[model samples]
Target: MTLASDDKVLILFRHAKAEQVYGKADHERSLTARGRRDAMAAGAWLHEHELGPELVLCSTAVRTRQTWEAAVDGGACGETVEFDDSIYSGGAQTVLQTVREAAGEAQVVMVVGHNPTMAALASGLSEGDGSSAAHECLAAGFPTSSIAVLRYAGPWSGLDIGTAALERCHVSRG
Candidate 1:
């Protein structure tokens, strides 16, 4: 996918790791301490680079929401944050649909969700040298608080092949 800031800026994030819950529902699992740290670090990295988004579209899952909340707190994004239930266990196609739905309202939009799907979306949208690295990273399974920035050059409503280009990717491990 060829990324152009014109289409939309898709910053895909894999939610931080969750603590093992012996009795809680899967959707309600919370983040681990290490996950919190990584989320903050991820947020700081975005803040330092001024990569704040115009809006945040995150899964309703506790871990995903917590990840975004922690990361976005260190800086100012000036964007609306909404919990989309569809994103809770969403795949690449579902994510793409959500992004397309939200594209018109914001210049930059961030999605916080799970792996495998996130990784799949990144691989599908990315091209060039880092594509392989990105793929490996995703396939290896993204650690908590990892972010991938993609540039799409078209209308958010009209996303398609070669529409997004990978700009940069960061992984927080500490």
Candidate 2:
């Protein structure tokens, strides 16, 4: 599927299961063993689907970083990876601001963070015209290591509620 010149692909990814008590701050907590496998599964799914992103905007938290690393190990590739502070605890709109501020020529952008921000953002951006099945899956709740693939024909700065269409949703579990 070819996109228009200004079209963009956005993949909203929620970090996998994280340790509740890691003897450190919540931001310092890392992914659990199962989380690693789930992350890898998510990566493999992306690879198989040819959804390789050109830019990855991830949270600065340890668990998010670990998830990205494990995803990479599983075959996910991105031209650039940016650890964004806003994504750490920023709400959905704040996270959208980060994407709006993104400076690059990347057409495919992936955001890795926690929820309900991740899920909220995905729901807010996607309209009702794409796939009913995808929306139904998302309505259930965004599980760990779940991803929502959205497509829009405009600049990132213009992305907002009902601006994009939810192409699909997937939950990868090890």
Q: Write one digit per residue (lDDT tens) for candidate 2, span 1-174.
A: 367789899999999999998467999988999999999999999898899888999999999999999999887888899999999989999999998889366789999999999889988998575799999988999999999999988778888998999999999998
lDDT (10s digit) by residue, model 1, range 36-140 = 888888888888777778788889999998888878665526378888988886788898898888757577888889877777787777644345565565556
**Which numbered prediction scores highest in TM-score against the true structure?**
2
TM-score of each: 0.87, 0.96
lDDT of 1: 0.77
Error of 2 at 126 (Å): 1.1
lDDT of each: 0.77, 0.91
lDDT of 2: 0.91
lDDT of 1 at 104: 72
